[model samples]
Target: MAASLCYMNPTMIVTTSHRSSAELWRQAEEWAQRIGARAVRRQGSLAHLCELHEADGVLTITNDRLVYREPASGLEYFFHPGMAKVRIHNIEVGRGDPMIGAMQLRPGDGLLDCTVGRASDAVVAAYVAGPQGHILGLEKVPVIAQLTIHGLATYEDSSRKVTQLLRRIEVVQADYNDYLPACADDSFDTVYFDPVFHEPVEKSEPMKPLRELADKATVTAGALQQALRVARRSVVIKQRYGTPLWDQLGITQVLSSRSSRIEYGIAEP
Candidate 1:
């Protein structure tokens, strides 16, 4: 399946939580400015705010976390490690992760995540990369990018190791299309792309909200070429099993797990 290019809804309003403090309001205003949205006072519920502002969604900045709410669907998106914690625990127990296997990551290696949605894979990659390695995640969507940046900086885990690894990831608000070309050859050990799956996974309820907010742009051949040029070892693409993207991109080296419907298509630079 091929993905069609789509962007975040422009009609989004940023507001503070109900009973918000002064600092939270200030932060909301700053976020609104950063994302090119209007900052409004929180009067009632998120749904009411959406109706009043005629916005497609409302981004509420609370003391604990940032929440993006779509009134129509009642979908709330926030930053969480999601399955990264489980993947990390699996790694700790000597279980293999398909993504880590595909990337062939090593300590001190540099990784560029071209489509770092919520930084879940990036967090897992960071854990495998260790202290000396670098993980840079590029996200084009404004609200999602900002939310990820904030989450990576603030979200904590029961394990100190996990918390530290999350902090190691660097989230950048830029599209890979513009960010990759300017890079020098062999800029990173690996470049990874996890575009929104063209076919939705029925069991992936957590991804539904993210899919709605993410950039639906599929990885173009030109972009893949740029990634190849930038990566020293290889470029990896993640897609649902049986996706035509593997053949369309001419990637023959594919990795998969018997338990997962996801597959990684790898191409060496």
Candidate 2:
């Protein structure tokens, strides 16, 4: 199905700055138009929807409110909707396997995924946290943002297993900067940053897709700096064996996720 889009009350807004909330929404709306996301319906304050693309889900501009709704659980999440050419990674392990990220989670932990991308990790984080915990996702690409929200929307009607899992998940289409400040200080126990995976190539640099989209994340830095500051416990940085999450964001230890490159970061105690 084609993705849908909406104005979420068409907030009292103005094009204040180059990248203000309204302006971002306007640009995002234009992109959504180019694609085919439609307005689904008005559920309370939010315009809930379905049929979203991956890029649509990543470019949201929320005005601080999280549009929390009841969740239903028994559904399998949908990741990467329309991308055709799947280039195989040299590593045997797939990047989206939730088990690889187990170390980044703890029972009852409130976790946030800043660089959500297609949001495979967000679904895993929510399931890992279980019932007592909460999962919040932030994506900034219009197509990806729509797809992610559609996943979250499906949770609203999940059966037994799905209901249990969906109860803890909250997904939104806002910039990390807007979302982070809205949360109280120390709101999360852990924050996860998987700054895309890059491997060496003989020619002069990296591979294609990862080399491209990995560099597009804005939330990674904001998520790292602010996620650490607002986290009550610590932050988890996911990177390939040799790649670093810059200088300031370092972990005390690592866990090999049964993959050659994908590694987990456990903050120092």
Candidate 3:
């Protein structure tokens, strides 16, 4: 459930902030080269820069964070823990998380996140899995992957425990469809997918930008088969409550949250 790299979009360009220093400029150029995109000097507003370069969007590297701006939508995407921090706090207070419950995660467990858009769920999973556990997230889009990689490495939460959990996650730029087949059977304790919901959640403002950038592909039968094979404990898929996806995938065991509209469909290998 991932798209091709951002470099696949020829209209994308990388640039430094308007007031960037020499080191930041150099870093921007390096990132541009790594992503196979043009590195342009910041001349004016992000929209003006996009217009000048005839690009769809601009990825601006600043001292604080990496920001991607889509001129048409005026949507800026940057990496933030978002709800993962809140979810982790809830867990710390004895208020359990639905995803943790669905996975029945244990210390030392390994989790493979198939569609790790922004990696909020992955962070939460890593926290529950503890120091002995390992979390690997797969994101096909190069820009999203890079943003997440940088954020997980650099972002520091007020809680040192949260920061440690974030650092434990490893982000890889690869589509799950291709990555899954390469992994050996029973390689991970749990394989998870959180594809962009077929029906959007109106109140999810943060998700709007992600949905625009992320691959919209639904979980395919073949991919589910691979997930089941690769998972030793369970494969959990996040979808809207009453989604036809569960029936379509022949998933009968599902965990629901009374307060939320989402459900986790679970299948054992």
Candidate 4:
């Protein structure tokens, strides 16, 4: 169970669970009691806002949901679009996380990290290939951009493994809608997307922080079309193991590590 509980305000508590799906709910309730904070479980995320006491806090059961939370980090990490939600296990940044562990990064290559929340994947990729390669992390939210820059700059000072390995990362605070055009045609080798994890519109929701952002940005097939447009090599979509992505898009399932199934959509040659 990967969960954290902290006081967001004098009265409210934010509990985050980033582990096994089955254990996430049980751990969330436990964290709430351990810290005496209000617990909001992020299950069946489809609505714009989950039930909350304040005007803030939206629903977020997927990477897409967090993107709307961008621009707001540090201390509370409020501006992050969420972490590098990928699957490539055994890599230090997101070790054992199949969503983060199953990445296919070759050495001495460049990758456009669509959402560089905490830069977990950027650091891991940089380490994998060495300094000849570069990673451009695009973020629309100012808070997340600033945090990523600061964190990447200071990463060397904190963890020797990451510090020596992450010198090639570049963090940019720009909406992808605007920046994707700047890249030359077929410029990048990979375009990775962890779109918001939303439930069917009618299901009951569990997370409150994600409610507001969901109202602002709707993660439909059209949004994903944008991701497909900007990539040259492959588009990687992260989702549940058994979930069928055909309803969302026509992505060919290409990789799977543990339970984090990765589907790839390659542009026509």
Q: What's the CA RMSD for each of the models?
A: 2.0, 13.6, 2.2, 13.5
lDDT of 1: 0.89
Q: Against the true structure, whose TM-score is highest? A: 1
Order the candidates by TM-score, highest first — what do you get?
1, 3, 4, 2
lDDT of each: 0.89, 0.47, 0.87, 0.47
Q: What is candidate 2's CA lDDT for residue 197?
A: 58
Model 1, 1-269: lDDT tens digits are: 13334563558999987888989999999999877899999998788888999999888888877888888987889988889989988998998788999999999999999999899999999999999999999998988898899889998888888889889999999889989998999999999999999898778998899898888888889899999999999999999988998878899999976467889999998
Off by over 4 Å in 4: 1-75, 78-103, 156-158, 199-229, 242-245, 257-269
In model 4, how large is the Cα lDDT of residue 161? 50
- Alpha-carbon shift of residue 214 in model 1 (angstroms): 0.5
The TM-score that candidate 1 achieves is: 0.95
| Per-residue lDDT over 1-269 for candidate 4, one digit per residue giving the tens place of the 0 to 100 score | 01012113223333343433545555445534543445565433312123343323321222222222221211123332123323222554445544333346667767777666556667666666567877788765443455466556644343455566545688887656556656666677666654344443223132223322222232235545555566655656554344456455555544554422333333221
Error of 4 at 37 (Å): 27
TM-score of 2: 0.52
Instruction: Work out the TM-score per prediction.
Output: 0.95, 0.52, 0.94, 0.54
- Pairs that collide in candidate 3 are none
Candidate 3 residues lying further than 4 Å off, grouped into runs, are 1-10
User: By lDDT, is 1 or 3 better?
Assistant: 1
lDDT tens readout by residue for model 3, 168-224: 999998889899999999999999999989798777888888788877778888899
Angstrom error at residue 56, model 3 = 0.8
Each model's number of backbone clashes?
A: 0, 34, 0, 30
